[model samples]
Structures are given as C-alpha cells and as structure tokens.
Target: MAAKRILIIDDEADVREIAKVSLEITKNWDVATAASGEEGVTLASTYHPDAILLDVMMPKVDGLATLVKLNENINTCKIPVILLTATIRLATQPAYVEAGAKAVLIKPFDPALLGGQIESVLGW
Candidate 1:
C-alpha cells in the first residue's frame, strides 16, 4: 500500500518534531509539519495529506478556527483531523465532533502508540 500522508500542525517546535519523528519511525508515513495554523493551511493545500494532526492552542488562528477553515475548503474538508489539546473535557467532545474533527487527542500522548491510535481512527 502507498504510505499515508499526514500533516501535523503545532505551535511548539519540539512537539512538531517529536510527532514527525514518531510517525515516520513507527508508521513510515509521509509526514509534513507546520508551526502555525496559517502554515498548516498552506501545507494542506499543497500537500493534500490524507490526515491531519492539529494542535488546539496556537497564535493567529487557533485549532478550532483552523479546523473550520479546513472544512470549508473542498480540497481539505474530507481529510480526517484529530485535534490535540492539553485539556480534553467531556463537554468539548461534542463540539469538536461537530466541528468535523474525527477525534480528540489529549496532550502528552504516548509517542509509541500515536500512529496506531491515528490509524484506528482512520480505520486503516
């Protein structure tokens, strides 16, 4: 099978790098990363990744807003998005789901299991 492409959007450089490496090493996915929401949108347009790992708290455009914009675009709307946040409340799950995110990833995730978790959500 062709390697699945994934785009990770995070404000923290370390987080982005870790996620990139984890996905690459564990899943052998085609991974691209952006440090901000704006960059993420641009990368998404150009890369057309199969899935996106988006961070919730970011400058300029937050994850929720970014997710909204992504869903508005025909080219990106179909791509599954898993939102990453430090705080995941039960009350917020419905809102995230309604906003088109496939799943909510609590921060401080297990790097070893991240790829498998994502694949499960994508039903790969």
Candidate 2:
C-alpha cells in the first residue's frame, strides 16, 4: 500500500520541522509543511493528504478560519484536521469540533508520541 500523507500547518518553523521529522521517520508517512493558512490550502489541495495538523493561531489567517475555508472546498472537505493549540479551553473544544477539527492537541507536545497520538485519533 502507498504511504499515508499528512500536511502540517504552523507558523513556527521548529514545530513544523519536529512534526515533519516525527511523522516521516517514525510513522513512515509522507509529510508536507505550510507556514501559513493560504499556503496550507495550496499544499493540501495539491497533496491531498490523509490528515492535517493545523495551528490555532496565525498571523494572516487563523486556524479556525482556515479550516472553514478548507471545508468550503469540496476536494479538501473530507480530509481530517486536528487543531494544535496551547490554550485549549473547555468552551473552545466544542467550537473547534463544530468548526471541523477532528481533535485538539496542546502545545509543547511530546514529539516522540506525537505520531502515535495522531494514529489513535485517526483510529489507525
């Protein structure tokens, strides 16, 4: 079977690199990184990844807004998205899910277990 692909959308270069390394090396999955929401949309559209790890806060376009835009496009709507945020309040989880996030992950996460966590969320 072909390898599963994941798109990571985050402003922090280090976080994206860490995630890419973990997912690619440990999970043996194809990984793509985007620095902004617009770039994320473009990459995701082109890559058609199995899942997306999106940061909640960004300069040009925030994660929620970006997710809505992603869902607006039929080609990208079916892809699962997980929100990566430092501040995940009780009130926001439901809203994020309502906004189309499959899961919410706190920042400063364990890079070692990150792929496993994503697999658990994806029920893989």
lDDT of 2 by residue, 9-57 (tens): 9999999999999888898999999999999998888899999999999
- For 1-124, candidate 1 gives per-residue lDDT tens digits of 9999999999999999999999999999999999999899888998999999999989899999999999998889999999999988899889889999999998988999999999998899
Off by over 4 Å in 2: none
lDDT of 2: 0.94
Candidate 2's TM-score: 0.97
Mind sharing the TM-score for model 1?
0.97
Please, what is the TM-score per model?
0.97, 0.97
CA lDDT for candidate 1: 0.94
Indicate the worst ten consecutive residues by lDDT in candidate 2.
Answer: 86-95
lDDT of 1 at 70: 96
